[model samples]
Target: MDHLAFDDFPDGLIVAGPDGRVTYVNERVRKLARAEGDEMIGMPLAEAMPFDDLNGHTWMECVRPYDGLNTRSAILEQSWYSPRGSEYLITASLKRDRPGGRVQQVVIGIRSARVRNRHDRERSDLVATVAHELRSPLTGIKGFTSTLLTKWDRFTDEQRQFMLETVDAEADRLTRLIIDLLDAARIDSGRLTLKRGPVRLDELTERVLRSISAAGSEPSWRMDIGAVQTVWGDEDRLVQVFTNLAENAMRHGHGLRRVEVVEAEREGVHGVRVRMCDRGPGIPPEARQRVFSRFWRSGPGAGSGLGMYIVGGIVTQHGGLVDIDDAAGGGAQIDVWLPVNEPEALRDGDDRGSVIGSGTTRG
Candidate 1:
């Protein structure tokens, strides 16, 4: 944990004394430069590291101290390319001793830019998805509302009722989409909290199914309420989990006909297993593992792509298991297993981490 232990740091680190002589180079830096550790210790930093920007500016300029003490200076980012075209981002900073005192030391940190660049692309993809998803519901609501308001007397009672109903449905969709976005942010920032207690899974399923039915999701549904017992969890969160899965089934089941939920015993595990199966095109074998990924979509549709991911997070927080399978009638089957005796929530020292984790496919 000391300064010298930078050797174990993931980022490359190097230190130069007041005279700009190389005082230390951690193992990470030595490995990155493909040079001996001791060989880099005594030489001038310029001769030892010799890092540079692609624009031809030497890293020596980047590490140079400004005209103040205790006022650290830094180079935000400098790009370097290896002989084989590998890229790195080197950030150098100067540490000062006291007000107007000499520069105490210069430190350089290095990290690969490949991962950062990939994340940038993923962020752009998320932005595009959000835009398209939000636009769909907004467009429907606007069109229907404007027509009804401007031409109220022109339509028959049935037609007006249909228009009003469509508007209401679109509004509801917009509200849910916004809530999903908020949930995603909360989950990512580790701010999601759960109120835990004993919850009846059978009753919760019936309530969620009633809501789905009221939404007019066109799918026949059945539930086998076994002699399952209560599980300790956040009742609202559990409701959200099944609601999400059921909605997902209604959406992806292009040919979706029947959706079923069953509570049954799982061998070798002291818990109840609830399976939600749909009769649709069925998730592709290879894609089953990735359906819970955030902002991931298997096809074109109006969805924020955060439902399944949120479902996974809530279940994980409750110390439960979730998996996918091929349903009996050739569709996706999602299984959730919750222990009758709920396990303690996970924590990190004093901070209680969020119940949800990253929805991104990669974690």
Candidate 2:
């Protein structure tokens, strides 16, 4: 409604009159098309900023914006090449004063292809990671089952139990991988739901510690909890959040040392902050932001690298945040903030908690 609103828009925009001449554009369009001020004005829209596909068809020639079907009201976004060879995505809206009437104006939107390109690369990475992660477990499960069936009588009871246990563990690995993938999909689609209730942060960490230690030898760990308050979150998801963090500590931690949960205020929101500190090599300042990305790993490590990604997603879903920092003395310290109050949208029974930012999820 306001032309000025488009002044600072992230993407470029252009408007054309019924005659197909450039009538208006935002500041973004000038830099996007490399045009000087008012230079693009009055020229035919296509002539002013020509873009073409691989087949050499100009955008105007392909869309035939002024000559298309009267009922056609818009053009779907598609890839195009600028005259300078940079990639761009273009879409346009066709407006008519009356139903089935002649087109009055064409409003076009364009943005650099870098963002979409990055997303495509990330999706490709996800596919490759999922395929590789799935193959190892599937191979183990298949081999174990095949051997058991082919040599049913040759193995002793203890050997049989070990083989079966291996298969079981592989199956569990597969299940966890699938669940992580599902959670990732939900987060990306903004469909992640949180069943919120009061949750004790201190008890949650203790439970996570027990689970991790039960899996193997206990690491050198000490937990100090201050006067922390209960947080509003899904107990199961919160458990997942902490479990992932604690497990990370045990893996790369060389050995976990100090664990702390304390009450604090950030941006006026009172919440509980849980820090899982480890004695291993701490994350570098430059890499701190990347640890939470999908499939990110410190090095060649076990487990699907989706743990921290899912951690951030779940925390964001609960209107909280997560962060990685240098720990006391040495090693890494991961901080998770959980707000003590129910997210406004959660209180209204809507699952969209992305409106919440910093200090209760991850800063």
Candidate 3:
């Protein structure tokens, strides 16, 4: 059957004859079985590929392919354990000569379960993180509002203000989380378009510092704005980027000390760079690779864990990059670089399309 065609398939493929004996099998099948030469050919299909179900029944015993109802045409993909106890996913297509007829051939496909298992783990992580963040603020807001509604006159003016402020802060946090989720969705779907423009790095950093000060930040903070030129990017999105980076520093950086905005010229690319340095225990070397990944966090906090991932997407969209390193003295440093070269055609408010496609919008 010119078995070479099936041998090139990535997943394991095996064909069983009408009598249920192995007619053909791929290299992947042989490799999985650890078979040598043509040893796998002509063997009983069940013995050649001994995958067992949760009940410890082999495929033949579980499915009873030749003995099943004549209407059955396929076996759905599912997880099973091989003879060596490694997990795998297997599926089958039963080729019949006619409806209600006996199965003429059984074509089986199998692959390792690692990729699906990893994706499932990541999805579970996202769900858990989102649920935790959502519950915290919602609980606070609900408790405070219910209390104020039932006992407004019993609380002093200062107490009332404190309660209201807490609610407001929680609301803002919820808003930020929602926006971050939307931004992440847009980035993932390649629909995150930038309204191109020239953004003043100095002015932007000043605005961020002002916002931080208004938030009642401590005096431990300092800034040094260098003679950097205006960068070509989206002003509002860049603000979101800087805000997330600065907030991440404050939240996880333990003792965030300073932010330095300076002109950077690297590899003939003239642009501006912002460094957020802290005095807290720095991130470990191994954990740095996961910094820009979605829903990643070092410890517990109010963050949605989507901040760094969004920041990375925005910076990448701007023809820039984001990296983490040890701070000047200690702690962790997050450096962001945005190139100054703007396409002559793209201007402020111009839809520059998504970063993935550059000039193409999603259909």
Best by lDDT: 2
- Candidate 2 lDDT score at position 339: 80
Q: In candidate 1, which residue pairs get closer than 3 Å at backbone N, Cα or C atoms, i.e. clash?
A: 294-359
- Cα deviation of 20 in candidate 3 (Å)? 3.3
Clash pairs detected, candidate 2? 320-360, 320-361, 321-360, 321-361, 321-362, 322-361, 322-362, 337-360
Total backbone collisions, model 2:
8
Higher-TM-score candidate of 2 and 3: 3
Residues 167-191 of candidate 1 have per-residue lDDT tens digits of 8999998999889888887778878
Residue 90 in candidate 3 has what lDDT? 90
TM-score for all models, in order of appearance: 0.74, 0.75, 0.78
Model 3: per-residue Cα lDDT over 123-221, one tens digit each: 898888888888888999999999999999999999999999999999998888888888999999989999977678767877876787678876477
Off by over 4 Å in 2: 1-46, 95-98, 101-107, 150-158, 225-232, 261-273, 316-323, 337-363
User: Which candidate, 1 or 3, would have the higher TM-score against the true structure?
Assistant: 3
lDDT of each: 0.73, 0.84, 0.82
